[model samples]
Target: MEQPAATYPVHGPSLRKRRMALGLTVQEAADKAGISRSYLQRLETGIRERMGPKRYTRLRTALNATNDQISPPPEIPTEER
Candidate 1:
């Protein structure tokens, strides 16, 4: 049997950069964002499973991230038979 390839969420780098630019620590940002420190850490490390639109919006707003600072994942083309 062959194993499946691994996939990682894309928000980690954006989150880390925004937090750093704001001169905020992980705990501070997490607290301001109403999420747990460990949860934020995991998200920042790409260890979290996935991200939804709502969560992305919230994180973006909470971090005061600009549009250029955050980008949605590229769309996967659909297959047609």
Candidate 2:
């Protein structure tokens, strides 16, 4: 059988959306969050999984996101899927 594409563990508030709302560019936001633009880009695009919790927290703060606004509980993957 053909396996399905590997989706991320969860869908969360997009960093890109919030950054746009705040009128910030990826470079600007990444600078504020003390990360590289490419890293932020990856996070926004879901190309990276499991950004470090501490760094994620910093990013949430830099983006001025409330816990409810940003945190998406991870989806548990089932073996038989």
Q: What is the C-alpha lDDT profile of model 1 across 5-78, one tens digit per residue?
A: 34324467777888999999999988787778998898888787455655655666788986556554568999
What TM-score, computed on C-alpha atoms, does each candidate reach?
0.64, 0.68
Model 1 lDDT on a 0 to 1 scale: 0.73
- Per-residue C-alpha lDDT of model 2 across residues 1-81, encoded as one tens digit per residue: 985334323123466778899999999999998989998887777777446656777787899976555545557988995
Error of 2 at 75 (Å): 6.6
Give me candidate 1's TM-score against the actual structure: 0.64
Pick by TM-score: which candidate is best?
Answer: 2
Q: Which stretch of 10 consecutive residues in model 2 shows the poorest summed lDDT?
A: 4-13
Which lDDT values do the candidates have, in the order given?
A: 0.73, 0.72
Residue 40 displacement (Å), model 2: 0.4
